[model samples]
Target: MSVEIRRVQSKKEKKSFIKFAWKVYRKDSELKKYWVPPVVADYMKTLDKEKYPLYDHADIALFTAWKNGRIAGTIAAVENRRHNEIHKDKTGFWGFFECINDQDVANALFDSASQWLKAKGLDAMRGPVSPSMNDQCGMLVKGFDSSPVFLMLYNPPYYNNLVTNAGHKIGQELLAWYIDQDLIDIKRLSRIAQHVMKREQLSIRTINMKDFDNEAAKIRDIYNRSWEKNWGFVPMTDKEFDFMAKSMKQVAKEHFIYFVEDKEGRPIGFSLTLPDMNIPLKHVNGNPFTPWGLLKFWWYGRNISAFRTIVMGVLPEYRNKGIDSILNAQISEYGGKHGLYSSEMSWVLKSNEAMSKLAKVIGGIPYKEYVIYEKEL
Candidate 1:
């Protein structure tokens, strides 16, 4: 059967594009474990020409693959100004990708994205980045044992084959580690960390929520400096950072967000963790706007069992000085005190062996894995 690819046009078509995953994964028991039903209204808002800030500086196209007049797959093509400005490259991104095991459908989606990017004069296309890599930007290649943690991508195993068969090569790989509370070597690390701290005059402390702006500024500086050498790294704009900070204000635990400062009070490193909202989000099937879903979320949020270590970074000069162990020890200490049992230190790059090894040293299990694929266009 031939698959026809067309840009999402009407409201109904947009709905079909966003909700196609539900139909594709409906009968698959494995897909149901951590499936978060995409909130159609909220997703559409992101693509709106008037509302989304990215729309102001980017060209976007949403395409749905149709077979026999029904949506079979979907993908979104974006040429983002922010990405271009940071990388100084005319590269485009393909995101929100989903499809059946059929090569025709995958080809249809890829062809549409390529044509759209070419029209924009982009030199190359790289993604599975739904809008941006700062968000979900990968396909699962290994470690598919459990449902994805909060904000991580989950897909069928065949998705990787489909992507590679479509000619996409490995662009980058992100790692996810599961930390079991029962097996942590916190006492050993704590003793070592104490010595390291005393020798280096380094101390770990929680960020002052009252002085969040000052703290955020320090984080911004450290993030830009620490991750500047990473592949596809972009210095987040002020608006982006502020937007994230505002969102974090609601769910961020004061103790879970920590900073390591030098003897002279310079911010040397930081780690940010959030209660794994996926537990409750899984119950709601991904939507939390309804009164019942909101109630369940509120109820479950108060008693979250797992936390996600979303961001952790140390300055270049501070690396390999046991600063990471100090940060991890602080997180484990706080988790023990707060009744949080387990944590997920995730989306680490596959090439980031140092961090991955450190995660294991702190008793984090390699549980989940996500992959990013690319194709030259």
Candidate 2:
């Protein structure tokens, strides 16, 4: 029973790759509880080059490893042009990776993905970034005790061995801080926030859903400016940003997204906390649209008591003026007001000291850790 790696070429093969994770998780019931199944159709859109706009700026190859006629693993190799253009680094990525506990299976999959990127002239390979860093990136290296909030990934504890066995070293660590709403010192943070707000004449507001396009334009401005210098960052194209904004609207609550502005009405910072959809999504089997699935989705959704702060950033010049504290305090206050008990401000880069300090200041626990691995291609 030798394992073999094959390229995903035909449509049927693509389908096989999309569905292979279930097989990997099916073998581990413990993993299954933490692993939320993605909607079959949603994954299809990600793999379909003509459909996913990301392919517009990225070159990619998909591969699967098989053993005894069963799918043992899957991976995607990607070369994002925008990343190289922005960072001036010839680095590629491997993501959407899933495999059995066997290091051999993991090696085969990595070998295939690496070879493909090497051929593309990429100097190094790094990731668990399914395609690009803007999306779901990083492999869960800690916090295996609980299920990941929606859009955050979950993997078995042993998966760490697969990367090291494949000769990859940790390239970076990403943190997901668990904030117990009841535990944060909001009163203290609030005092700081008020001081900063009054001194800077800063005011906070939520997205204007009535004029969403206009609102999105403001967010786009802050996002591009705030995160331009962050590691592995590439600003999303106008088309990409608009597409994301439109899609997010489907699940958005106006109160959950915030904007902080100066007295002159310049948007200086933003934070987006998506309600933890995983609670409901888990029951819906990943697709929220099937008749019964939608019913289950809404039913479970009403009981959602948490959120994940997907992204939060401030313009570089405004970094030390308590903007981060304001964001944390506001999020804590909002969650408590709404009767939410828990939230996660996640995927924070380990190198980001400001965020680490803010997490500490707000009583956030680094409960989940995700990592990016790298190797010379």
Candidate 3:
């Protein structure tokens, strides 16, 4: 039977696209315990053009692959004008990709998106980024033995085969490192932390909950500018970044959030690590509207035993100035003292050699890997 690819035109088709991952994960027994289901409402918000600020600069189309009238796979094709303007490349992105093992189904889904991009004058296609590089991206090709941390991507091991068979090759590889509390060198952390602060005239503090809106604005200034040179980078508009800050605040932990400022008291660098809320979220099965599920989430938020490092960076001028080490040390010491057992420092790009080497030097094990696939359209 041939797979039929069609544009997602109706609300019912869109619903199927959002919920298709649940079907895929449930069908695989191996993923039962390891997969953490995202809140359905969040997915809906991201897909909503009126809500997701990225749509302000880019155009997107959603497609679904149907076989015998059942949803077989889904993908979103995007043409981000801002990304091309900054990078000087005519490229499109295919993301929110979910598919079964069938090569025909995968090819049909890929072609559906590829053709859309090609029509837009994009010469090369890349991604698994729903809308842009700032959001959840990449396909899991390694580390099926554990659950993903924070907003990282996860898929069955066979996803690699699907993308490869569809004529896509690796565009870039990203990694996640597992760090155990027992291996954290607190004394070393404290020593370097103090010395760096003194030498660089820097002061460290957590986000003031009362002043988070202002703090987030400051971080955005650094975040957008610092990462401008990164591959696939796209600066998030203020509204987009503010929306993300609002979301993170819901589960933000004080100790796990650190911001560094110069002696003159201007923001310069920051690091954010959230509790591994997925540990309890896996039990929700993607349904968070229930009273029991909401209660369970609150309980896990307080008793989380590990953290997932989400974002960390220093201003370009502050780079290689020991700010990175200070942030890493502060995170490790705080987690260790708070009874946390482990953390996943993840999605570090393969091209980021400094961070990759820093992870290893700090007793991190490269436990997982992910990649974005690319092909000329």
Candidate 4:
């Protein structure tokens, strides 16, 4: 029997595309435990052209593979004009991928997305990024024993075979490191941090919620400047940055968000960590707006003990100056004081030697690994 690929054309089809994940996970009891149900309303925003700013600068097509009168897999093909303009590479991306344990279904889904990209004159297809690198990206190739932290991607272990069998090669590997509170020598860390801060004439401060717009702009500037040379990094537009800032602020802890500055008061770097909302989100079961869902959310939310350090960066001029140490030490002190001892430092690129080394120095163990795949179209 041949697999039929159909372009999603209606709201019903879109709903099916998103709901297919439940079916895929239902068959794999082990994988289901680690899967977090994304709030349905929030996930739908990605599909709304007017709602998601990415649609303004990208061309995206959603497709579903059908066999035996049922949906077997789904994929979204994206041609991000902004990414191509910045990188000068004609690359497309496939994301929102979900498939059962059928290679033929996966192949059909990949082939359909590839053809869509090829039609747009793209030279290569790379990703599992829902839209781009700044958002949810990567496929879980390792560490399936625990649930993912907030904003990270996860898939069944077999996803590796499904992708490679469909002709995609590993393009890059991203890491998630876990630092246990007990392993950290806080006193030593503070001593080193103080010495570095004094020598560098740097000061650290928490984010000022009252002056959020101004603070967010500063962080965005540091983020864009610091990550400009990184692999797969595309400068975030003001709107996109603002959108992300708003989402993160909902769960952000003032104590965990820090800005590093020179004595002259010019911001040089920042770190943004949030309590792991996924812990409560898993309890909501994808609907957080309903009365029952809201009640369940509040009940589970109070016990959120996990944290994910989502973004941290330093300006190029500030690098190699131990600014990172100051940031790490501050996070540790604050987290310990608040009874949030451990956290996940995630999605660090394999090519980012400085950050990876810093994580290891702080007793961070590389527990989970994710990979992005690529193939010539």
The digit string of per-residue lDDT tens for model 4 on 87-186 reads: 9999999999999889999999999999899999999999899978898999998899999999897788898999999889999999999989878887
RMSD of 1: 2.0
Over the stretch 1-377, how does candidate 1's per-residue lDDT look in tens digits? 78888878887887778888988677687777646666556577667767655665677899989898777899999988877888888889999988987889998899999999988888788888877766667888787767777777778888888888889888888888889887887799789889889989988889899999889888888887888887887777776676567767777888888899999988899998988877777776557888998998787777888989998889999988988888888888777777778999978998988988898798877776777777778
Best by lDDT: 4
TM-score of each: 0.93, 0.97, 0.97, 0.98
lDDT of 2 by residue, 1-377 (tens): 88898889988888889888787776787988778887777778777888778889998899999988888999999989889988988999999898988988998999999899989889899989987887889989888989989788988889899998899999999999998988888789889989999999999888889998998888888899999988888898887788778878888889888899999988899988888888888877667888999899889888789889999879989988889777777888888788999989888999998888888888889998999999997
On TM-score, the stronger of 1 and 2 is 2
Query: Clash pairs of candidate 2?
Result: none
lDDT of 4 at 10: 82
Better of 1 and 4 by TM-score: 4
* lDDT, candidate 3, 2-26, per-residue tens: 8998898676767778899988898
Which residue pairs in candidate 1 have backbone atoms (N, alpha carbon, C) closer than 3 angstroms, thus clashing?
Answer: 175-348
- lDDT on C-alpha atoms for all candidate structures: 0.82, 0.87, 0.86, 0.90
The local lDDT score (0 to 100) that residue 349 gets in candidate 2 is 91
**Rank order by lDDT, top first?**
4, 2, 3, 1
Model 4: residues with Cα > 4 Å off, grouped in runs: none
Candidate 1: global Cα-lDDT?
0.82
Report how far off residue 18 is in candidate 2 (Å).
1.6
